[model samples]
Target chain A: MVTLGHFLLFSGLLMAVGLYGVLTRRNLIAVLMSVEILLNAAALAFASAAAFREPHLFAGQIFALFIIVVAAAELSIGFAILLNVYRTHGAVTDDAISEMRG
Target chain B: MSLTAFYALAAFTLVFAVFAVTTANMVRAAFSLAITFFLIAGLYLLLGSPALAAIQFMVNASAIPIMTLFIIMMTRSRSSGAPRTWQIAAGLLAAAAALVFFKGAVGHHDGQINPVSPELLGSNLLQAALLPFEVASVLLLLAMVGAIALARRRSG
Candidate 1:
């Protein structure tokens, strides 16, 4: 039986993995991917909680769906910003684009 | 807490979500994210929120991730070698947010306990308290518009 503890453990571990990716990855897209993972972990935890509790309060699931949609929207902006950074500099690395810092 | 199908599905959901979030390959992340979304829907089903589950499957798993993959494919081959200190700083900021929010999240349930109702999700958006869902849709639309606008070529 996967108790709530198990779910919490799994979610926590996944979140930590995501944290690693977010911290170390230098690629903007890769960083965004890590964020997505983190968000997914939160969603899973919320839905699981809904299942375990009164089985009546569905705000958790609704909130999760809301989160997913927001994540999608957030990603589009991130990708576009990455594209903008690339068009001007011809490189997406943060180090090379430092000339505009004056 | 036995190893029931619910547990199995939840485990799968989390695994795919990790795969999605941590994988360096963009296309693969998109694929795993789709699975993660579906698994979340499955969780909703087990919790008697069938309507929300179906929406998760359709909107999140099917629609959004596919769109992300399309964007990735379209943007592939672009030179994105890596980022520098400023970029690193941005990532650190996100990490900070994660750390700040995660610790006390366990006890921060802030909403009224609305009884789980499949019909609540099934009914027309205009009728129910669909404010959150509607706002989410609007946010996605805004993102789409903003991204397209940002990608527009700046006239010299």
Candidate 2:
């Protein structure tokens, strides 16, 4: 049986991997990539729960859809910002982009 | 149970995620992220939410990651690598916490779920959440505009 446990485990692993990337990556784009992973993990967990709960678990699915949409939007803006930073600085290092680091 | 198929798909998703995240190349990472998202969309299919699968495919797989890839292309970024050590360590620790939290939330044991789903699964997902959906759409538009604005060079 494809149990809920399996989904949870896989999603958990995905989340961890994403977390590792988000923490470790110096590139703004890479960090954004990690955020994508994290969001997908959340969607997996939610969808699996919905599958087990009731026939009308559309709420969870819809919410996940929303999250994905928002994620796309967030990434677009984030990339733009990164590009801008790159234009001015010629570099997009995570640490170096900070102006408020004082 | 479809244990083999289920395990196979989830494994595919997991492995791709690892490749996507760990790969040093930024463009490769973007591609990996897209693959992971696609496989996760398959997971949504298994979970009886084809609406979610479609949305995942359309948005995450299509519109979003491609945008990232295009941005990378536009920038021609020679840069590679993520943050430094402490940041990576912090992410790992937090991800570990998330795993723990998820495990607890799902309970101690795996439930026997019926993977054979109905045809009209979450078909109305978009209809019901129309308002929030529209708001999200607007946010996406704003984000696109903001990205372009950021990318633009100001004239002297």
Query: What are the TM-scores, per candidate, against the unseen true structure?
Result: 0.71, 0.86
Task: List where candidate 2 sits over 4 angstroms from the true fold.
Answer: B105-123
The lDDT of model 1 is 0.66
For residues A41-76, write the lDDT of model 2, one tens digit per residue: 887776776566653646655666676777777777
Q: RMSD for all candidates, in order, please.
A: 5.1, 2.8
lDDT of 1 by residue, A1-102 (tens): 344544555566557657756776655666676777777677767765665665443556666767777777887898888788767666554464688797
Q: How close is candidate 1 to the true structure, as a TM-score?
A: 0.71
Best by lDDT: 2
Candidate 2, what DockQ?
0.64
Query: Can you write out model 1's per-residue Cα lDDT over B31-131, one digit (the tens) per residue?
Result: 88788777767766655567767777887778877767665665563223443576456656665666565555445343322335666644533454478
DockQ of each: 0.35, 0.64
lDDT tens per residue, model 2, B75-104? 776356645677767877887897787776
